[model samples]
Target: WLKPFWLKGTSSSQRPGNLYSRPLPPAAMKTLHQEESIKVPKGIKVTIKAKHVEVTGKHGTLKRDFRHLPIELYLANSGHEVRAKMYFAKSKQLSMLRSVCS
Candidate 1:
């Protein structure tokens, strides 16, 4: 009798996976903290107080409250720039952090 095509191998250990597979090194851990800074234009005024921000320009003014946001917002670089920062973020929260920073 003729053996099947797959059965032509020497044994289970002779399979391609067994011959090529290897234990890879552990992956590096993801960062938990992220920070992004944005510059403010000379003609525009940005005000940051706690989690609240107000942006004023020649056209109009905008106010926002970020107390419910997962990330933290602040003014930096001598109040000439704004920063978005997040701390202790995991996989799920990483998306949120990136979305806000973007």
Candidate 2:
């Protein structure tokens, strides 16, 4: 269930004389484009596949399949960061990756 809109005003904070009351100007608006990266532990090993990613750490190996996505996954920064790069991601693809990564 969701909270009612009327309750939002009571729960949210409104500071006095706040300069941020107005929204950003059109010229100040910026596009957000980010690449997701997961850190690779010192003793971990990673294998990047076209449809899946395999990671082997001190604990064990973890594999995840991303066959349906339109993004590319790889290792970066001397294999320390597992980066997910997307050329043009649909909403489904973005949400799927976000859930899995988070």
Candidate 3:
């Protein structure tokens, strides 16, 4: 008669050999910390202060506070563009901020 495998106190899900016993390459690790930027509209005026960002346009003015998350807002391109930069952190949150700004 044939014997069952479960009676041996081992299962098929167990790995017999090393699965992840090596370190990633330098190039691969560098990609983990990436930088991203967002541009401001041409007509709109974006002012980044210590705590929040004030956007003014032909329609009206809007203010957005950023005291909750660990993000930095600043201007680039010789005061022609506003960029939101991120470094070595959660990328998912950055995408959410980008989508909302756009």
Candidate 4:
């Protein structure tokens, strides 16, 4: 019987391990922190508590719930700015943070 070329001298690592049928690479990954902020105008009130943000201004009060997201939201610069932050962020998380911040 004849044998295929790839089957003759291949190791386990050379074999494809996913649905795409492509070999997986052995590499290291890093995690870091991500932060984004926006300034709050003088007349607007910004509050952060219990994974929620409440903004009060001439247009009335608006509140948003962020409990579902993995990032942290806080007030900084003496309540002059609002920031969204995430620690030990992976690539997937970084992308999400960027979208949310921008």
Top model number, TM-score = 4
Off by over 4 Å in 1: 1-30
Candidate 1, 9-99: lDDT as tens digits: 5566565568545566877576678887788888989888878889999999989887787788888887788899887766677677666
Error of 4 at 60 (Å): 1.3
lDDT of 2 by residue, 1-102 (tens): 566665554433343345664565765332244477898878889888786888888788889888877666788898888887664555555676676566
Write down the RMSD of candidate 1 (Cα, Å).
6.5
- The global C-alpha lDDT for each of the candidates, from Candidate 1 onward, is 0.78, 0.70, 0.64, 0.80
TM-score leaderboard ranking = 4, 1, 2, 3
Per-prediction tally of clashes? 0, 0, 0, 0
Highest lDDT model number: 4
Candidates 1 and 4, the one with greater lDDT: 4
Candidate ranking (lDDT, best to worst): 4, 1, 2, 3
Model 3's TM-score against the true structure: 0.56
TM-score of every candidate relative to the true structure: 0.62, 0.57, 0.56, 0.68
Error of 4 at 12 (Å): 7.1
Clashing pairs in 1: none
* Per-residue lDDT over 1-102 for candidate 4, one digit per residue giving the tens place of the 0 to 100 score: 555776667555555563446745865464667788889999999898988888999999988887888898889999999898888877877787777655
